[model samples]
Target: MTAPPAFPAPHPSPLDLGGRTALVTGAAGGIGRACALRLADAGAKVRAVDRDAGGLEALAEEAHGLAGAVEPHVLDLTDLDAAELAAVGTDVLVNNAGLQLVRPIEEFPPDAFHTVLTVMLEAPFRLIRGALPHMYGQGWGRIVNVSSVHGLRASAYKSAYVAAKHGLEGLSKTAALEGAPHGVTSNCVNPAYVRTPLVERQIADQARTHGIPEERVLSEVLLQDSAVKRLIEPEEVAEAVAYLCGPQASFVTGTSLVLDGGWTAH
Candidate 1:
């Protein structure tokens, strides 16, 4: 066989988020905060939304020195009316707000299950539906859903989380199909356990559930599936979110970009 030349690597597009407005839910926390910062750094006016007013304010303060401005909003995604969310005038919508509940399916509390579903799945759907009119009118928009590797695979004692993430993926796919003709894109970044307060809380729960030490739960349970054998960094996921929101990803939609560090490779 004849030798073939190697393909050149593609370069990233220059930052050009100027004149754009992005609304990021859960912007007060780990991955969400990173995403907000990245978007602002790329010159997009960022509307940082979270239930925690203090954290949102902190984020806004941090972003004030960046290329773009941050507007903090203490909005509870679960309780917000559709019209209210639409009024934010978002060009890119990141449905990043989520909660984790760990319990065996048999022992899972009904209220807890419903709450998780409401926040993770239902809230994103409603936000997208509400934001569509604005995006459609502009004829350009991006919707990035921060999902989890659990959306692709299941684990013990995570019935509600898995179900909600799986449902979110389905919803994103359907939205992509519908938004295609409108010059809008919908996709997801499904990451494995990131080293965040959320995952820290899950560590304690996992330790309690398995009757194992927290260290063991982290090393053997949470990171067991990944070939990297380490928790993913929040900034790594944030970078992926930014790429999806950028101009280069115009044709990418209805896809789940897994940041699982080879967890799903097996």
Candidate 2:
């Protein structure tokens, strides 16, 4: 049999995001804020959206000193409209807005469950649908969804949060396949317990649930399943998001980048 012909090596892309715009929902705090700052530092204009006007303004102020501009919007992702999103004209979209509720399925309120689903899963779907037109027109775009380790595995008292995150990952994978023809990529970052305000709140909830002291919750609950003893930092998750949005990641899509310090390794 004849040997197969050698394949040609691919050339590197020349697209540096010097003037590109990125829309980051929940950009006022935690991993979202870190991502906005890092993208701005890399020369991408950032449109920071959050329900908290004061927090959004703070992010914009901090980003003003970076290489790119930051535009703050006090918009709630739960009530976002396509027209308003299109007006921002973003080259990249980061769906990071989410809420966590800790309650057994039996005790979970209908309204709260719906609220979590809307913010975590439904809103991301809507944003992706709205953003695709611009991405197709430009023939280049990136979508990064901030999922969680819970997306893959489950625990008690987080039925709504876990379900939404798992759904978000599936949605991202589907979007990636659809966006491939338009040079757009979609992926999710699944981080372990990060020391953000969200996780801090969970600590309290977990302590209450287990009848343990708050100080022992991290060691006994959050870090117990991981090989690493420490909680993840928001900046670490931000780094993963940056990589997914960079030119180097052009071929990486329809995947979940897990930053769990080996939490899921087992």
Index of the highest-lDDT prediction: 1
- All predictions: root-mean-square deviation over Cα? 6.8, 9.5
lDDT of 2 by residue, 1-266 (tens): 11123223223223356888888888899888988888887788888878889998888888877778788877776784742464345788998887887777898999999989988888888878888888889999999999999889998899999999999989999999999999999999999887678877787788888888888887888888888777677777877888888878999999999988798999
Residue-by-residue lDDT tens digits, candidate 1, 1-266 = 11123223223345678899988888898889988988898899988888899998888888877889888878776685842464346888888888887888899999999988988898888888878888899899899999999999999999989999999999999999999999999999999988777987787788888888776887678878988767777778888888898778899999999999898999
TM-score per prediction, in order, is 0.92, 0.91
Would you give me the overall lDDT of model 2?
0.83
Determine the C-alpha RMSD for candidate 2 after optimal superposition of all C-alphas.
9.5
Best by TM-score: 1
For candidate 2, the 10 contiguous residues with the lowest summed lDDT are 1-10
| Model 1, position 99: C-alpha lDDT score | 86
Give lDDT per model, in order.
Answer: 0.84, 0.83
